[model samples]
Target: MQLLYEHRSPPRTGRKVALIITGALMVVALLIFPPEGLVTTWSLWALACALQLAGVGLLALPPVIHLWITRREIIIHPTGPVRRLPIQHIHDMELSGTEEDPVLTLHLRNGEELDLSDWTDNVPEVMALLAQLGVARRDA
Candidate 1:
C-alpha cells in the first residue's frame, strides 16, 4: 500500500519567540558595548544567541524527523538515530484518549510496546491519521 497520512508535533512558537527576544537583546547589548577584554567577552553571549536560534528553528520543524511506511515496515528517525520496525512485527496500535493524555503505544510481536506520543501533534487530524495507520483507541 502507498504511504498515507503524516503527522508532526506543533510548532514551538513560544520557544521561537523567546529565542528571538533573547537574540535581539544580545544584539542590542553587543552594539551598545562591544567586547573589549579577553576575559570579559561578548562572544559567549553571541554564541548562546546563535545556539538558541538554532534550537528554536529545529523545534519549529516536524518532530517526526524521518518516517517511511510501506506494506512491510515503518521507519522512524528520532534525532540522529533511525529505527526500523517491520509491519509484521506490530501486534497492536493504541491511541490515547485526550490531548493532555496523549500517547501512541505500539505493541510489537516481541511483546514490547513503543510509545510515540512525543513525536506527534495533539490534534484530531493527527488522531485520524493514527486511525488510518491502524492505530485504534485502547478503549475501542
Candidate 2:
C-alpha cells in the first residue's frame, strides 16, 4: 500500500522543562521554610511534595497524536496505542464546525464515530486524503 499522507505532532519540551524547574524550586522553598508550622510532620511534607511533582510531570507530558494515511487505511498512533481504520469500514464522514476550525467525524460500520478533530488539528489534510480514497463525506 502507498502512503499518501503522514502527520506527527511536534515535541513540546519547553513547557515540560519549565514545569519541572518551577516544581523543584517550589518544593525546595517549602522544605527550607515551613508555612508557620502548618505541617508538623516531615513525612507529610515529603508526601505532599512527591504528589505535587508527580502531578506537574504528568500534566507537562501531553499525549502526542500521529497519523499515517495510506490508500487502504488510516492509522492513528497515539502515545502507546495504535488504531487502524480501513477505508471500507468507514461508512461515512461528517465535516462540521467552521471553515477555520473544521471537525471531521468518521462513522464506522460498527456504529462507532470518531471525531478526528480531537486527535489532531490537521483535519483538512485528512479530509483531502479520504476524498482521494473516494470515501463519502457529508457536511453537517
Question: What are the candidates' C-alpha RMSDs?
Answer: 5.2, 4.5
Alpha carbon lDDT at 30, candidate 2: 69
Q: Count the backbone clashes (under 3 Å) in each candidate.
A: 0, 0
Q: What's model 1's overall lDDT?
A: 0.65
Taken over the whole model, the C-alpha lDDT of each candidate is 0.65, 0.77
TM-score of each: 0.51, 0.59
lDDT, candidate 2, 1-140, per-residue tens: 77787676665655556656665776677668766654654654676666667657766665565777788888888345889898999988999889898889999999999988876778888888798798898766
Candidate 2 total steric clashes: 0
Evaluate residue 82 in candidate 2 and report its C-alpha lDDT on the 0 to 100 scale.
89
**Reference-based lDDT, residue 62, model 1:** 62
For model 2, where is the 10-residue window of minimal lDDT?
36-45
Model 2 scores a TM of: 0.59
Q: Model 2 Cα RMSD, Å? A: 4.5
